[model samples]
Target: MIEILSPSEITRARATGALVGRILQTMRERTQVGTNLLEIDEWTKDMILEAGAKSCYVDYAPSFGDGPFGHWICTSVNDAVLHGMPRDQVLADGDLLTLDLAVILDGIASDAAISFVVGQERDPEDTALIETTRRALAAGIEAAGPDARLGDVSHAIGQVLSVAGYPINMDFGGHGIGTTMHQDPHVANDGRPGRGLRLRPGMLLALEPWIMVDTDELVTDPEDGWTLRSVTGARTAHIEHTIAITADGAEIMTLAPGASS
Candidate 1:
């Protein structure tokens, strides 16, 4: 369902969004070569509980995915892109890792994701992949406002990724997020502008732009039943932010406390 949150609800949404941002930032800081994926999940759980918040993903079971994610966060490593279920795998240098998180605070939910290299050994291609997602996310956010159409955001994001030569995956894109983790207004990565839903003030949208290096296809791990990996095993990157539309424009709700940008 598409929800147009009230002013008070929007206020609470900021809290949820910032919490998500801080948790992700903390995860990035603690992650390194040799760190286990399960370790990341545990840390996330401790922080969420300490904050008196609830994870939107722990009990999340949707038709497209295997029942109940059963994890605190999504740890997508290297070729893995979305719905990556954390496991016992240890990170290695130069591994591309994406941490996607969402949570409910004061009954409002917000979601975001970040992709980064694990260690000091950074491959130029990996670095480019992560940077491209960042730029695309920024472009998508810039295209959003009270007067903008959802397709404008998608077009902006697609423009950047396409120019960078990465194939966009349509299976999973952005979506409306408010009282729950996922909602209406499926925001595709690429689409025609000036079409689709017209954004309204107090609306919250989670805009994520993800791409695979050489393919648009995705394959799920049979045993894990989650982890969406590139069919070609090429490196991938994903970045997301929960945005709140205002009378003037869009404000990024997921920037961590004390973040300059």
Candidate 2:
């Protein structure tokens, strides 16, 4: 379903978005070598509860996933990219970590993700992958404006990733998000411009651009049935933010206060 937020709904959305952004930022800062994945999830739960918000993922069960997610946040590390279920493994130095979070405040949901290295031991490839995804996400947001077609946003994101030499995964991408977590007007990472759903004021979209280092293929972890890792086990990265379509342009709802770009 495509949901257009009323003025009051938009105000609540901003609040929810700020909460999600702050939670992800805090999680990223807290995640380091020796930190357990479960610890991260715990932190997320605490923060969500402190904000008096609901988790969009904890009880989320979709066809692709095994069952209810049963977790507060998605802790995807190294090869893992999307839907990563928290585990007991402790993070090591230089491990690439991606934190994806979604929450509802005042009945409006906001979603966002961030990819970063665990320690100072950053690998060039890992850093590049993360930077590429961030750039792609920015490009997609730049293309999202009132009257703009969904394809325009997809095309912009794909252009950046392709130029960076990363393959785009079509299986999962961004989508409309509002009172519920995932909604209609599927936004692919790559598509032909001037096609697909046309943007309108008050529309909310979670635009995410993720990529695996070597291939576009993905293999779900058989044990957890949630983590989506690269088939080649190569490094991966993801960047996302919840955006609201406006008359003049797109307003990024999930950015931290004073955050640049």
Candidate 3:
């Protein structure tokens, strides 16, 4: 369902967004070589409880997934991209990591993700993949404004990734988010402009642009049924943010307290 936030609801959304952003930033800082994925999930749980917020993913059970996620955060390392369930693997130097998080505070939910390299930089391809997703996310956000069609945002995002020589995957993308983590007005990574849902004030959207290095194909991990890794084992990256539509433009609600973006 599509949800438009009331003024009070928007205020609650800001708080929820802030919490998600802060937790992601903290997790990114704490991640390094030798850090366990499960430990990261524990940290997220502690912070979520301390803030009196609810996890949007811990009990999430969708058709595509195995069952309840049972994890506080999504940790995608190297080949893994989306819905990566925490595992026993320890991060290695130069591993490309993506952290996706969602939380509900005051009944409003916010979602965001970030991709970065761990320990050290190894391959230029990995760095480029991460940068492309980041740039695509920025382009998508820039295209979001009151009265703008969802296609405009998708077109902008797709143009960035396409020009950078990355294939767009439509299987999963951004969407409307409010009281729930996922909602209507599905926002694909690529689409024709001047089409799809029209933007309006008070509308909230989570714009994410993710890409695999070599192909658009994805293979779900059979064991966990949550992690989606590149079929080619090529490195991947993802960047996303929760934004609120406004009369004049889009307001990004999930930026960390001290983050310039």
Clashing pairs in 2: none
Supply candidate 1's per-residue lDDT for 151.
86
**Which pairs of residues collide in candidate 1?**
none
Residue-level lDDT for 224 in candidate 1:
85
Cα lDDT tens digits, model 3, 16-106, are: 9999999999999899999999999999999999999999999999999999999999999999999999999998899889999999998
Tell me model 3's lDDT, rounded to 2 decimals. Answer: 0.94
Per-residue CA lDDT of model 1 for 1-261, tens digit only, reads 999999999999999999999999999999999999999999999999999999998999988788899999999988899999999999998899999999999999999999999888979898888898999999999899988898899999999999999888887899999998899989999988998899999999999999989999999988889889999899999999999999999999999778744
Where is model 2 poorest over a 10-residue stretch in terms of lDDT?
252-261
The whole-model C-alpha lDDT of candidate 2 against the native structure comes to: 0.94
What candidate 1 gets wrong by more than 4 Å, as runs, is none
lDDT of 1: 0.93
